[model samples]
Target: METRTVVAECIGTAMLVLFGVGSLVLAGDYINALGISLAFGFTLIAIAYAFGRISGCHINPAITLGVLLAKRIDIRRAATYWVAQLVGGIIGAAILFLLAKQVPRLQTAGAFGTNGYGGRSPVGLGAGGAFLAEVLLTFLLVFVFLTVTQKVALVGVEPIPVGLAYTAVNLIGIPLTWASVNPARSLGPALFAGGGALSQLWLFLVAPMVGGVLAAVVHRFTHQRPVGQAQQEQAAEPPRVGPWGRMRGGHRPEAGGPEAKGPEAA
Candidate 1:
């Protein structure tokens, strides 16, 4: 299970960065942000649905950590997921590097589609705004995730809800944080951007986790079931065993055998 989850994260994040940054490499002079934001949103749900049964395919450390605190995952497994996400991001960027090398302008910069802040922002947004944007965007994503994976999970049409919620997150966050919401998503781009992107990378990592933690805490306290759940559980069982020992507990006497006092007839 552990190994499969790690493989899933690595593969999923790879696909995410590949298509996501690849879209950027191919972006025209103007519509880069719009196109890339859409890729990021849709790719999130695509990967989650594909590997969700395996690793829950978070593809984002902040999401993974939030789930961990909500008691959805153990620490060891969460650590593995984070490593897989980061490594996958790098590998994705490396492959993008190889592919973009064939292009003209992209070859020089190897525009593997990097992330940035301050003077580097695509829209010229500042660092402080970017950090806040990341925190809120990732928070909304993790919160939406928490809703879908609940046991006795919601009925049909569940995936659409989570997917659309992610899309909505993108709609709001794109201008400011470039709609990162996922650490590995930003990390890969920052690695290629280097310099300021690398420096501001800390904000991308820290803010999301902070928001995720806060959302988790609030969700936990507010989403508790009524104490009557115990009564509802008790009401579901059938009547107890008659002359037989406790319904499911003690062993029953063997028929026509020693315990039944008829062994000689055999």
Candidate 2:
């Protein structure tokens, strides 16, 4: 079960980087901000459906870190996920580079689409601006993820809520910080872009992870453990009563029992 979840996280993260960063390498400014956002949002949408059952479809390191800090997942599992996410990001970057090699006169576009601040920013925003944007955006993203994935009375298979939430987040954030709610999304790009991107990588990773942790902490205050964990605890506890409770000398009656003429017989 744990293996499946980890696998899903790795695969989903890879898919996200492949599409989102892939677009950056294939189409420079032509892909535009909105298109890039859609690539990310759509990848999340697709992953939600594909891996939701296995790992709740969390492919972002910031998200995983946030949830872990919130105490949703144990340390061991969270560490495994973080490792998977990093490896997956590197792989996705390599793949994007490979695909970029096929294009003509597209050298500049062949980056991993890494997120950066200052001069590397789409709008040339500084580190402070980028940090704030990442913090706010990722906070919203994680909060929405917690709510949408919640199993309410009428709400089941929470993929749509999460997917739509991501799309909406992207719509508002694409113009700013290129909407990197997920750190790994920004990381793949930096690996290829280097220089400015490499220098400013800290903000992209730190801000989003911070935002995620904040959201997760808030989530914990409002709710108990996840349904799955609760169920596991319940299952682990011993049953209250045993077969003896239901056997021969049980409560009042015996197999050949007669009223024995209660007080009236006396």
Per-residue lDDT value at 182 in model 1: 76
Q: 52-143 in candidate 2: lDDT tens per residue?
A: 77777778877777667666678887788888887777778777777777877666432356666666666888778888888888888887
| Cα lDDT, all candidates | 0.71, 0.71
lDDT of 1 by residue, 234-264 (tens): 9997646546443334434343223333675
Best by TM-score: 1
The local lDDT score (0 to 100) that residue 11 gets in candidate 1 is 92
- Model 1, residue 133: what's the lDDT? 76
Task: List clash counts for every candidate, in order.
Answer: 1, 4
**Residue 41 miss distance in model 2 (angstroms):** 1.4
Name the 10 consecutive residues with the lowest summed lDDT in model 2: 246-255
